[model samples]
Target: MGTWQLVLVGLVMLLGLLGVLVPGVPGPLLVWAGILWWSMSEKTTPAWGVLIGATALLLVNHVVKWLLPARRLKGVGVTRQTVLWAGASAIVGFFVVPLIGAVLGFIAGIYGAERVRLGGHGEAWAATRTIMRAVGTSVLVELVACLLVLGAWMGAVIHG
Candidate 1:
């Protein structure tokens, strides 16, 4: 890739990393797309290897991000409906309040769902904490994976 292309790819990857934090941004997908673009453009062994590795990492991330939280939630007796509610609420909150509102809305949504289902504040709060923990862990995993992918891209760039 040309120097300008590499720079552009880097900028796009950076945006992807930030997308990991921002709701509805499709962060992992963006990162993958950038990497794929660069790799195809370069058509080198290192680039291909990095692309494959990143593909695996992202695949694992997607699976685990859903599974771990779901398992934990199930273990704690959290219903799928509650999770759905939280996600729906988070979407609404994102539109209603923007940035921070999504987080706030998610918490509120989960709590509201749990409260309605369980009919107890304490139980709802406990479930909310567990959900938050799971979310945090998923985000952390995604962030790390994205960073690793970025590193791989940079390494290919440098070594290419």
Candidate 2:
């Protein structure tokens, strides 16, 4: 792929990463499509390998997401803003403390948002738990899967 094409692919992947946070967005599919586009353009062994791995990984991600409990944010009263905060925090955490930090940051972000909204630690914690049980696992799984795919693509691009 040319430099511009690579940059465009990277931009698409980044958008897909952000899409994972927003409800109703086909984040995984977008990420996979970006990989496919890059692989087709590059036509190298590593590029093809990355595409295959990303496809399998994202397919598993979809299955796992389906198996998880459906999101019930309305029942739990978790707002979209809270989810956005959690996602933004997760991104920062991923870079700040690596893999584990993402989880910690997500949980903290939820707690912080709930604390601000509910005005008490106890209530916020309860709401946080409810929110997590309702939707956190699904989002976390999808985010991690996309991150893995993005990381693999970056590695291939760098090494190829």
Candidate 3:
């Protein structure tokens, strides 16, 4: 890739990273698109190989993000209804309050669900903390995976 193309790819990767934190933005898809953009422009074996590897890693990240937290929640007695409420709240929050609202709404939703189900603020807060931690862990995993992909792309740009 040319200098300008590399710069563009870097910018895309940055946006991909931001998308991980922002609701409604497809972070992994954006990262994969960045890889595709770079590989298509470079057309080198190493670039293509990196692209394939990143794709595989991203796929695994997606599966793990969903399964790990879900398993943890289920193991801790969190019901699917709570998760659904949180998801629905996130959607509403995305429209009502913008970028940060989704996260806030998700937290509130989980807390609310637990409060209703368990009938105490202490227990509800505990559940909220658990859910938040799981979510944070999932986001961290995605961020790390994205950073690795960005690093690989930078390496390819430098060494291709």
Per lDDT, the best of the predicted structures is 1
Candidates, ranked, TM-score: 3, 1, 2
Report the lDDT tens digits of candidate 1 across residue range 72-104.
778889888998899999989988996799898
For candidate 1, give the lDDT of residue 111.
98
The root-mean-square deviation over C-alpha atoms between each candidate and the true structure, in angstroms, is 1.3, 8.3, 1.1
Q: Which runs in model 2 stand beyond 4 Å of their true positions?
A: 70-132
Give me the runs in candidate 1 sitting further than 4 Å from their true place: none
Model 3 score (lDDT)? 0.89
Q: After superposition, how far is residue 147 of candidate 3 from its true place, in Å?
A: 0.7
Candidate 1 whole-model C-alpha lDDT, 0 to 1: 0.90
Candidate 2 lDDT (Cα, 0 to 1):
0.87
Better of 2 and 3 by lDDT: 3
- Kindly list the per-residue Cα lDDT of model 3 for residues 5-47, writing each as its tens digit: 7888888889999999887789989999999998888788998
Q: Could you tell me every candidate's TM-score relative to the true structure? A: 0.93, 0.63, 0.95
Choose the strongest candidate by TM-score.
Answer: 3
Q: Let me know the TM-score candidate 3 reaches against the reference structure.
A: 0.95
| Better candidate by TM-score, 1 or 3 | 3
Query: lDDT of model 1 at residue 67?
Result: 88
